[model samples]
Target: MSGVITGERRSADTHSARSGGGAFVPEATPLDDARAQLAVATGLLGYSDGLHAMLATPRRELTVAVPLRADDGSTMLFTGYRVQHNFSRGPAKGGLRYSPGVNLDEVRALAMWMTWKCALLDVPYGGAKGGVAIDPRLHSKAELERVTRRYTSEILPIIGPERDIPAPDVGTDEQTMAWMMDTYSVNTGYTVPGIVTGKPISLGGSQGRASATSRGVTHIALAALKHRGISASRASAAVQGFGKVGRDTARFLHQAGLRVLGISDQYGAIHNAGGLDIERLCAFVDETGTVMGFPGAEPLDRDLLLELDVDLLVPAAVEGVLHEGNATRVTAPVIVEGANGPTSPAAARIFADRGQLVVPDILANAGGVIVSYFEWVQANQAYWWNAAEVEAKLEERMLSAWQQVVDYATQRTLSLRTAATVLAVERVAEAHRLRGLYP
Candidate 1:
């Protein structure tokens, strides 16, 4: 009964939702974009409507009320969601995020993307995602901890090491995971280190896990540049988000000899045509908590950063940053997505028409999940690998997946996104066929 939502019904439900301003925005939402992509891949793979519906619908969805007690003795109620998109290949695995924009549809899209990401990388995980509708920036550390614990407790019925594993995402990190692990452990009356990943090293987290996503993005970006006949030493990049993923991605790109010209955080963007000193900028951000007001670069408009005339543009921020409105203005010859779903369907069409190469998110930013799988394996085995070994394994996996996607894209004359999705969807669909349906 759970997977009964047909494609038509799903489309209707997705389109009916309105934005905060009471406008029936006609543009594609993240869920719409995700379903559209899947439809294309399924069509190419010769899948029937029944199997497409099975792939489109989430296997399970949970919504919970997360009430947190503030330090000021006030109660605030927040909504949280966890959507498990698929489970045919293996256990569900994804990240838990905290943001004001967190919603059921966004989580659903993210969970579906996670499924493809895992499958593309050959990791043993189905796609799942969890998020709370609260901004971590506005809350105190204690408040965030309370929110995480309460959210974890509410979703305890569905999450576990071998069932559904949560890692860090947008507004969440290792400390949040530590709290969730502690909450789950206290409830079960035993320690469950594998319940979550991205924890502190002291808590059995894998080495090199913190920067794994960024590392992976850098690897793919360099490869993409090379494929386009751009040398790393000559290429310039503009990273349009300096948060968890963007900050480290910029650093890695700079270290790899790319001239990182622009970087942006939520506050503002800064640019240096001659290339900014990434290490110095990092130190300044560490001291001031923003990329704005850095002595080494002049302030640039946040939106213009996306349109910069750079060789490589990494939109490592949030979803839909490179949508219809500004897709035409984006002049970057190559784009490597660091954030999930950064380029919408319309934007992708524009890029295709313009002959711009886009390295899709599932293939470009899978380093985190690849290493998360390693961490989970380590926890389950009660043994850990050193940083060198972990990174080597991650690089090997990332490069292998990149090569596979490139070859598939070239062979079929399809874009990388379509090729990656087709590869992942085919794998999941084959697994489902092998397992068959249960009465």
Candidate 2:
């Protein structure tokens, strides 16, 4: 495990050069954070060194060169990766991201998180993540399709409906999944809609799959508020990162009666003490491509969104946003993490010391995977579920998991993150022990 961790760190550092015009963004080491998290859980379970090392290392990983023929009759090369962190529970499942900062360590970290997330939700899937270090925003539709197909083909041996499934992430969306599914199907001489989730609804995708994560966040946020004796109508929130997760999170929070006082995106952030209209703000983003200058709010520094004096704060954009530098200034009593690793270990400790309730990402954002499981079942059974049925099941599963975590935390006097990780690690370790050593 030490050798693997050291290799990943070297790989990340070797490939740390900035791509195109994107500046080098320094952030916390996700791989280290992941290892630290595993250490805590292993300590709690009293696991042996061998077992701890086994859980820390990934089951399998692949790095490939994705060659793309540009529209201008030129060739371009990009590095891509797929890491299957664990598969003791079931098939591996995670997202494929495209960004300038994509690296092996980040994917490894994300894959590890997915393992715990599936166990926490009892979703019957392990963890895997794939990524390509190319900015989709700088590429054309045709270029992205070519890259997706080539990348899928390169790692085709490991991915399938029953093996490892890939879904959308930061820079990938429904179209990207559609391309991967089509490419895999073409090679196999038949359609394989189950190869990926978050595909177009017409292509065997679940009705509520797209917004599942945001909906799950809302469910947990509301539950946290209730546990704190706060009413949703009187509550207020500030959301950071108004992208896929953030935008929908804001809308759902507003719909649930929380006054969304501030919302931020990559361009900038907007605020209104009296609560801005979410519907119009969404429409404005759709038209102008950002929330920078929405008609109903005033502009403020993006970092200020984290310190807003609201009942709830959601960091739905990127990782390491809530680090030691700003964690002490946070005023929100409850934080529902919509993004993976949004709160660093140091910041989490700060929040814990301050008596803030920090909902772990694995528990808060399990809705997407829950519905992905439903979609996979529907695909295998050749039957689909309606939106209402899907949403109801998602809500039920999310709330059940939430209650389990809360109870465990309360009983052991542990933080929610520690409780959730401990529960998940125990489940996975039990499965591994039952399966025994396979030659």
For residues 335-375, what per-residue lDDT tens digits would candidate 2 score against the true structure?
99999888889889999999999999999988889998998
lDDT of 1 by residue, 1-439 (tens): 0111111212221233234454444567789999999999999999999999999999999999888788888778888899999999899999998877778998999999999999999999999999887777878999899989999999999999989999999889999999999999999999999999999999999999999999999999999999999999989999989988999999999999989999988888999999999999999999999999999699998878999999999999888777766778899999999999889898899999999999999999999999999999999999999999999999999999999999999999999999999999999999999998996
For model 1, what is the C-alpha lDDT against the true structure? Answer: 0.91
| Poorest lDDT segment (10 consecutive residues) of candidate 2 | 1-10
Off by over 4 Å in 2: 1-27
Error of 2 at 329 (Å): 0.6
Candidate 1: where is the Cα deviation over 4 Å?
1-26
Error of 2 at 61 (Å): 0.7
Q: CA lDDT of 99 in candidate 1?
A: 76
